[model samples]
Target: MPASKGSRNAVSSAVQQIVLSPSDADYLDQLIPAIKDAAHSNRTAQLLQGLSQFADNHESEIEGVCNTNHQEFVNSVNQLLQVREGTVRLTSEILDLNQSIQASTEKLAEHKKALVDSRSVRQNIDEAAQALEDCLEVLRLTNHVHDLLATKNHYAALRALDELQNVHLREVPQYKIAEMIQKSVPAIQKLIAEAVMTDLKTWLFRIRETSQFLGEVAFYHTELRRTRQKERAEKDPFFRNFKLNSAMDLVSDETDEFDVLDNDEVQVDFSPLFECLHIHEALGESEKFRAEYAATRRQQKDLLLPTSIRLVGDDEGGSLSALLESIAGFAIVERATMKKAFNLRSTVDVDELWDSMCQSAINLITQSLPDIDDADALLKIKGVIALFIQTMENWGYSVAALDSFLLTLFDKYAELLKQKFSRDFLEIVSADDYMPMPIQTSEEYEKVVNVSWYTPEKEQSDISFPCVLPFSQMYPLCCIDIRNFLNQFYFFSDDHFQHPSVIDETLKKSLDELLAQKVCRLLVDRLSSQYLGQIVQILINLEHFETACVELEQLLLAARSPASAGKSVALNATEEFRSNKKTAEKRIFELVNSKIDDLIETAEYDWMAPAAQTEPSNYIQTLTRYLSNIMSSVLLGLPTEIKELIYFDALSHAATMILALPLSADVPTINRNGVAALALDVQHLSQFVDSLGVPILRENLDELQQTVNLLQSDNSDEYYDVSTRNKKYGRVDPMNGPLLLEKLTQGMQSSGRTDKYTTLSSRFGKK
Candidate 1:
């Protein structure tokens, strides 16, 4: 196989030489193995082996190039060593140069230190020299300022001293100069204070010498501002800050020596000057105002007093209404003037002026009251004072003084009234023609007892009762006076007079006492005598006694009632008047009762006449008629209980008269049935009066019934029989038990048939 491969290789080589020839012998030898290897079945391994041989050749060429490079690296190392040698030399040269520079720097610093020390020494010398010069200047200025102050050139001295202080050389020299200024300040201050004082005094003198009232000072000060504005019209007037104590300009110069040194501006107080500057002109003006006000008050008083009184009474005498109107008008003017003069115009703070003025007003009214002396002047005076008091109260001032004066006036007026009314009462009492008794005839008596007075069968004359004075005439005058008093002092009638704190109750008591003691007593004393007896007889005859009682009661009550009742004296006066009333009432009742008893005792019945005459016995009819007249007239306005008691007494007396007188010959003969019938009429009359619903009337009615019942049961002299037990028990008759029950039954039955309240029987228990 090798021989064939080698022949192939040679052939291929010859071909290859023609295609790609190999130049070396080894190359050919190597190519032949590669050809053989390629021709073999294992050509890959052969190709690899050829590549490895090529790599080895390449590695050999690389190693040869690396050797040439190693020689160049040696040359470079040598050059670097040469450069290192140059750097070392240069570093040495630099270090030697650094050492030389360091030596020079030390030398420069030493020179700078020396120069700085020399400069510091020169600055020190210059500062020391300037300070010495400043000290010299301070001493010179101090001496100069002291000299200026010695000459009292305060403004110049102050300037120089300020300049000295500004130097501030040393505290000692400055303090020494301040001491000199301090010592000189007192004299400088005195001169400046004198100048300021002169200016202030000039201003004050100008103000005080102004010819004006002190009250015009505020206005004058206003004028000062106007004058200043006009005087400096060309310039804007500097409005000074109006501090209350803006006198600082004057005060600052008036300083003590120590005060000057302690502060730049010494403070001085000018309050003493203000206090010393008192205006005597104000005192004079006040006195003048007082005199003027006093004169004005005098003129007002004159016009108010007699002029007011003249207005009250005309030349003939003014009417009450006109007098009051004038007094009130005067009071109004006085009040207004007093307030305006005292409160507004007068400068006096003293109350004496006002007090006197108030007193004058009161005095004017009081004095005017007594100035009236006419017959009716007293009444007019009272009216005037009342109007004056009312007017003053309406004016709303202090009324204590006026009220006090009024009390005295009222007392005096009351005393005067006592005299006037007493004299008037006495004059009328002595006059016989005032009230005369009328003559009463049998026909008049017959008419009175017949109960037919509305149309009397017999014509009767005018029947007049005797009176101390006709109440119709005199009493109206009293009413007029009372009405006048009340209307005049209307304020007193209000709630104000009731409280003792407001009005003097003692004065009220005295006034009431005067009326009770004088006026009321006059009426009572005059009315309670024979004249009263005559009046009572006439009233009883005409059955008007109850009317008299009520009139007297009203009069007594008015006398007892006073304006104020809180005082003990007023209470005592009321008690006295009440006692007088009771006495008068008792006397009046006694007189009327005596007359009634006489009529009852004299009553007689003419039973022997015809049946018509017997039907109403002359005695019984007369009694009943009289009683009817009595009830109709006297019991007109009496209280129900009083009327019942009166009627009971009249009926009881009639029963007593009938029971006491038997059916004897002295009386006209009458049958037992007639007596029984009379008894029935008596019972009926008793029942009629008993219907007034007074519990007391029931007992009297029951007694009357029993008396009539006995007269009917026993037609004998025992008609008024009193059982021993009943008499001892104060019961005069047996009770008419069945009769009363029968009457009550009839009353009830009749009441059911009639209106309950309107029925007579119903009036019994319902009332």
Candidate 2:
């Protein structure tokens, strides 16, 4: 656009000031759009006029700006010229580089082709080398496994076989040697397993034999240890004063006894067992191995139990103690073997194998129980079992099953003992002769006093030899039987009953009941109603039996365990004996009364005839002689008080018999002479009663004498006087005097003594 000089200069100055370099071209181009917009809108003149006014208004500022930017514009033109030169140079270099790159690419492709061909050969060589190495490794491992198997190193062979199959064989899958090794792997594994199982079987056999040897060794050591402990305890002062918690504590505290046998001589090899375990574990049959091991041991343990228990005295290991020791020794060895070899803490880990073993033993012992008849043998078995229980409990095994078995054994033993005692007592009593045991010599007396049940109240020196030996001195054969039975019983009980498991009180009670029922009561039932002399002897025997029983009761009480200290078991035999004694005494009196009745029945009186003699009747003489013989001989062993009682009672009964003779229905009437004979018999009876030295015996005899005296009187006035006077007939009723007078009158009339009878009747009847 044409403009003024100042405007043209402003425009030039603005152009120069804002020189459009390549970076400013965008700014100039941006302004071209606005300039074109103005031109197209027909605002070009107006735009020229606005620019002229802007150039005139700030001319100095625009010149200063131009002048300030003049050198910069010049530097810009030079830089642009330099840039153009550099651009031409760079374009030529780029063309040259592109041609070189194309040539290098073709050459690189040729070299790559050759390198690929060589790499293929190298890769093949590396693969062959790796395959060879793998084949060698598999062959080496296979040979090594065979060598291990040959050397019986089954566990190592199995491990090497694993490496060959899982790692080395994977490397050489197509190789013949690898294929052969792979095919043989199963056979090798099977061979290893079979070899391990064979070794295990051999180990089982060796263990079985070794267990027996070890059991015997253990038993020997246990016995030796017990002997040593006993010797030590005997020497120790404190042991005498103090008791251990249990006798089992002594054995239990010395667990080191097994250590003494852990030397080469006694130690068993466990290499085979460990190999079996490892090989089985590797073969994925660990559980099967455990089951097989357990089953084999269980079968072996079963074999340890006897089919039947041997009798105690039959053979070397026949005794209950020996058999139990053998069993216990085996159990101990087995327990230790399991704990050490298998790393098991207890038999509990193997499903309580030890308890199962004990059960087998218990069953065997129980099955043999019926054949054991001896109470002592049963007791020995029971003691052995109790000790076994204690030993097992100390070894950390459950004894509940064993404890139940022991209780059952105890019950059986108790019943057996009771039956034995009962049979013995019955036999002794049944065969006993009802006679005083003859102790004629001092030696015999000493033997009697020395019996176990004969605990004398006084010293032997102080005791005198009685005419008849007391029951304490075994006066009867049954007493000796009692002594023997008690001796045997206490011998069995002393050690057995002291054990905590036994109920001593119950056993003692059973014994008491047995003695009462089988001995004392038996004696009473069999002897109380026998003859008087036998009854007398039984009474004496019963007295001694009571004394013996009292002593036995004391012994039982003293031997009782402390747990039953509050309980008391009084022997019923003592009371039964005492009662039997009383029964015998009464029975003796009854027998005497019966004899008197028989004698009285044999007496015959002639009431209507004249008196034959002035002496006593034959019956009275026989009665007195019989009584004298009994008092002097049969009742001689009886105490003086009892003898006197029997004498007085017999005499009084005789007097009663004589008094009843005249009133008997067989005597229709008594003549004066016959009455005189009867009065004479009464007088003889009174004399005999007076001689007995018992005033009570004389009373009945005196009454009989007074009645006979009244009948013997010739005067009717005397009969009237005796009947009216209370002093004359103090033992007789005064009101019966008329009846007595009338009977006398009738006798007189019957005998033709009418004068005397009429006077007696006239005098007493009217009164």
Q: Which candidate tops TM-score? A: 2
lDDT of 2 by residue, 33-143 (tens): 434444345444444455445444445454455578967645654564574465346335433544454456567778899899889989999999988887888889999
The segments of candidate 1 whose C-alpha lies over 4 angstroms from its true place after superposition are 1-407, 417-479, 490-507, 518-523, 526-588, 603-617, 656-698, 701-730, 733-767
Colliding residue pairs in candidate 1: 314-318, 604-619, 605-619
Q: Any residue pairs clashing in model 2, and if so which?
A: none
lDDT of 1 by residue, 650-753 (tens): 55555655554543335433433444555655655565555554566556545555544543442222322345335432343334322232243343344353
Per-model lDDT:
0.43, 0.66
For candidate 2, the TM-score is 0.69
Worst 10 residues of 1 by lDDT: 275-284
lDDT of 1 at 257: 16
